[model samples]
Target: MPAPCHRTPSIKMVRGDITEQSVDAIVNAANSSLLGGGGVDGAIHRKGGSAVLAECRALRAAHYGRGLPTGQAVATTAGRLPARWVIHTVGPVHSRTEDRSTLLAACHTNSLRVADSLGAATVAFPAISTGIFHWPITDAAPIAIAAVLDTPTSVQEVRFVLFDDAAYEVFTQTWREWKQ
Candidate 1:
């Protein structure tokens, strides 16, 4: 049997790949180009099929070169996953000069804004920038959690789906502290 719904405006952290998750929507850490690339981008594209790319192509044609400033987001159909929508947000790559915290916060905020625009009640998020972007899971977790908690939307549930044990542990530990 399925687990009971907690029925609260709370964030839940779980260990798993975002592609395999069943939720209202999944957050895609996309490149500015919006084309499928490595890590979460590749996984979502691979599972969601070419249709997603086709749709993105259309969107890019209309909105390309406009520059979707960091932290802003757009939505498209899920294509293949059990979700109804895919919310794409751009995240920052770790660098010596960039404000990593601000960019990471933007990622989380933009995702929530997209979900809210779509009237989504639940959403799943991968640890943005924790992979190839190298934002460091330890730093990303708290910023992500804070962004989700800070959103004013009526979104009923938010999930942090970690791709590995280290990411999961970081999120779980941070969540524990945030709750108390």
Candidate 2:
């Protein structure tokens, strides 16, 4: 798919597949295992091919043996994917009993940090934990947008690549509210 338009104070919300985004980097909403699971993680691993998994395995062998911690991010080769790098971040699962908003926000903030370290000007991010992890899009949207906006980074473009209309609407609405 075509890359999203670049605008100053850049943040764009797109409804489509994250793997198709032709950006400098794409953020993977990965589980702690970082080995690959369902949802966005699986799609990225599949499309990015063995080179991606190979780097992930090397990461595990070298440093993340216990797996990546929640709210943390690590970068790997994008393999056959369009982007140069895949920033894999582990988002906290939603919990009714405990507030994990900070952890959720960390996923976005940390991913941006990694993207900046890689000198990636354009980055695409999925709504972290909003799928199998059960993070309600309503609550997740604002945090994701806020974290990206609040963080200091060199990234010129940030695209929240939502999987569906509902998520796209929520993120776009949240972004609009923030802009206003």
Candidate 3:
């Protein structure tokens, strides 16, 4: 099969809370349950308000009864969030004996696809699977950047909203390396 045609978007990195990002959509590194869990998922749900949960529940009841699977994405109203929508994507748990890089890449690609479908021109993403999922930041950085760079989407900007200096540095360095 032919590889997908890639598009270049304005990629930026920031060290801050993702909930504070003012964009068209925020990508939540969510658990499969989609009800909310630790790390980025919990923060997004907490700040986004009950309206986000309500839509999640409705989605669960209407379609995702078994819960959202890893690497797939779904969208909900952002509620009180600065963004118009939240694209929830479940990333795979890292494994020492198994290579799950493809699933990690899928998380970013799927979220972008969801964002494009919603006509979101700018999107903010957290480091999916790098927290409690135990995926190393170094290993995850390339998969994420490559996925976002390679995917064809109408979105105009993609921001990596890192929670700390270390993650922000890693992503920044990766971006530099990719550009070279």
Candidate 4:
């Protein structure tokens, strides 16, 4: 094969809290409300402080009055978090009878698009929907990785900030396998 014409971003797997990531943007595994709730959303809201909530409130009052739809993404000031912007994407809940993986993948793709629009060179993402939404790590890992790998964006670096060993390992192994 010929040399690649474009750059594929450097992917990093850091087993840590996404809230503390010091990147240009951090992807929040947010709920539709965007007012903040359990898991990553709650942590980001608590750590990022009132300014984050203020922006979220403004977003709700403006375009998201009915709440953000699943798979779509929006950006807000990172507030006290180490990043400059926070890209919030609501992931779909896992359903056994119905395949909702496309929505999950869209969460990653749309978040990257929002990050690119902000000129964010680096972004950190949490394992969206794998927590409260109950998306299986086994199924979610490949979808997340493929979405990032397939999407075209200006971001130079993408880091998956996993909170636990299970999430981290799944991402790590999935990425390694995908590279082959």
Candidate closest to the true structure, highest lDDT: 3
Error of model 2, residue 69, in angstroms: 0.1
Candidate 2 lDDT over residue span 1-180, tens digit each: 233222344889999999999999999999888889999999999999999999999999999999999999999999999999999999999999999999999998889888878889999999999999999999999998888878877789899999899999999989889888
Candidate 1, residue 12: CA error in Å?
1.0
Greater lDDT among 1 and 2 belongs to 2
**CA lDDT scores, all candidates in order:** 0.82, 0.91, 0.94, 0.92
Candidate 1: give the clashing pairs. none
Task: Return the top candidate by TM-score.
Answer: 3
Residue-level lDDT tens digits of model 3 in 1-180: 233235688999999999999999999999888899899999999999999999999999999999999999999999999999999999999999999999999999999888888888899999999999999999999999999998998888999999999999999999999999
The Cα error of candidate 4 at residue 103, in Å, is 0.5
lDDT of 1 by residue, 22-97 (tens): 8889999887777788999889989998888887888888886664556778888889987888888888888867
Per residue, candidate 4 scores C-alpha lDDT tens digits across 133-173 of 99999899899988988888878999999999989999999
Each model's TM-score?
A: 0.91, 0.95, 0.96, 0.96
Alpha carbon lDDT at 103, candidate 2:
99
Lowest lDDT 10-mer window, candidate 3?
1-10
Q: What is the lDDT of residue 71 in candidate 3?
A: 97
| TM-score sort, best first | 3, 4, 2, 1
Count clashing residue pairs per candidate: 0, 0, 0, 0
